[model samples]
Target: MPTEETQTRTGEAPRRPRIRLDQPLTPRRKLIPDYDPEAFGRMSERIARFLGTGRFIVWMTVIIIAWVAWNVAAPDALRFDTYPFIFLTLMLSLQASYAAPLILLAQNRQDDRDRVNLEQDRKQNERSIADTEYLSREVAALRIGLGEVATRDWIRSELQDLLKELEEQQRSVAKGEVFPGDGDRGRDVDDR
Candidate 1:
């Protein structure tokens, strides 16, 4: 018995004795590089590092150092976040609170970008699938045309005539009977 592969362009399967499954044996998700949750998750460390710049570290260090220096050097009146280090402790606590959330926010933005990239990739894959289907249909049409041609003799005669014409053209070129862009003679033969 013939298989579906040998079927007509009309989408009918070849005559067979047995029933076939409607579903494909293996269906794959056309995973175009879309926003992968795992890929976005892995970028957390890098985004955190980028957002926690050298300037941020330097300013935080300076604030702590200056606070310490003022408390130690001042004669009680110059003390604001002073001696038993209440102000310093408060500032450090505040920094810690804000820093974690900022890093997380940066990661969230990166995740959004990854999601967009994935969506674009999926669209491209869909377009590719559409193009593939179109070409497949065209190929099926050509196959049907070849199948319907009733006379082998007519096809053979046509091919032989085409080949003879090509041979004559080649022989003319070899004998220098043709020249580059000599439009008149080429047009004359083409008309024939």
Candidate 2:
């Protein structure tokens, strides 16, 4: 018998599977290494907090004043960024640029945390409301069920009614209107 592969291919060699050469085989590496996003966010928050403090402002002012004094008083050869203080201005601007984004990032993270906390609080409030309503319903059901049950006052009233009827029956028997051994025959004899 002919081989199965030769029979199907009519003596032609088996075809190789097609490959997609246009696409990359492996993922490309990033220029910078990956870092923990949460850590970065926390760092940005700390930086933003420090930037907002009065201490930071005081230190920055002192440094700028010292820089200006040095540049103005120092000899020409030693001076850097003289009269206009262009370098100092540029450094402040750069710090401000970086500060703005870090502060905004921290605020966004805080907002996200607040949103999650609010959602959790809302769910807890809903659960509390549901529990309160369930308890209220249970209490109402118990009240209604207890209304149908006999209580001490109700038992006392029923016993008092039975005692009054027995007293009336005893009075009739003492007047000879009824006898213990007979039913209506005693009343009939009395009538006769």
Candidate 3:
């Protein structure tokens, strides 16, 4: 136990000493409990937001409309991409190249955001734990101080005084001391 000296200021009660906050993190302090992803309820929300983007909708629509128009309107000579559809195949390959990377980029951004949020949560938990530990230490110190000042000596004195008074009363009763009375007095019938 580390002990320190303290004194009262004017008429105020004496202060209990305490350790400084600049000290390193200790196991006694804890903020948030263990984190569980299922308990956080955030995975579904992120997926929904990604699926609803305008860019995804636009790209899908353009691909479908272009395929239909090319089949219906192009004559044999006008069809630059014929039965084998070499040009159409190249166009699809180009789109896939860009689309696949864009999807990956979006996923990477989401992962970064999740990492940042998790770090924030962890710091908040640490602060909470430190605060809880500080409060517990202060409360324990107060209890110790109270115990020292509110001693049992006064209670013991009071009990002793009561016992002396009871002994005096018992002596008086044993002496058969009584005041004179009209022993022959009788009650009248129907007296209110």
Candidate 4:
């Protein structure tokens, strides 16, 4: 047995006492009997499912009709429930009492599953949006880079301009006019 007093070390202020993490927890006897909750939940779901089926409704209707017919037509000694049908009403009420909870339990389980699925879908949509945004940004960057690069049509136009400049310089030299920027090409051509 350990005392409930707070443990303190030197130079530390007293804090609220808590259970020791290093020690094993003591087993407690519960007031209610312990059972597997998961198993019970599954059983309740099964019952709820059965109750919702058309076959269950048909069977219940047939049984009730038979019960009514038997009590109405059968002799007094054989009939268990008479004119008021109190026993049938009690049985139906009992069944409703149990069925309501089981149906609610099944609905709760379905709600939990739906909530988890919705969360996963939301996360998936978020990731998809992020991926799409990232891809779009990458595409935009590539388009910008491609715009900066010289295309074949631009290169062709630039080469045509250079050719026209060279033709004009040749004509000027042929007419014996000295073009200032012709440099070594003019001298080399004259020597040739």
Q: Which candidate do you rate higher for lDDT, 1 or 4?
A: 4
Please provide, for model 2 over 69-149, each residue's C-alpha lDDT reduced to its tens digit, 9 standing for 90 to 100.
999999999998988999999999999899999999999999999999999999999999999999999999999999999
| Stretches > 4 Å off in candidate 1 | 1-51, 143-192
TM-score of 1: 0.44
State each model's CA lDDT, in order. 0.75, 0.88, 0.65, 0.89
- What's model 1's lDDT at 147? 84
The 10-residue segment of model 2 with minimum total lDDT is 180-189
For each candidate in turn, the TM-score is 0.44, 0.78, 0.46, 0.73
In terms of lDDT, the poorest run of 10 residues in model 1 is: 183-192
Q: Where does the lowest 10-residue lDDT sum fall in candidate 3?
A: 178-187
**Candidate 2 ranges with C-alpha deviation above 4 Å:** 1-28, 181-192
lDDT of 4: 0.89
Badly placed stretches (over 4 Å) of model 3 are: 1-62, 65-69, 72-74, 149-192
Cα error, residue 160 of model 2, in Å, equals 1.3
How do the residues 1-192 of candidate 4 rate in per-residue lDDT, one tens digit apiece? 223343343445665667899999998989999999899999999999999999999999999999999999999999999999999999999999999999999999999999999999999999999999999999999999999999999999999999998887778766776455664465543544
lDDT of 3 by residue, 47-100 (tens): 445546897689778975677577658876665555565677788788778656
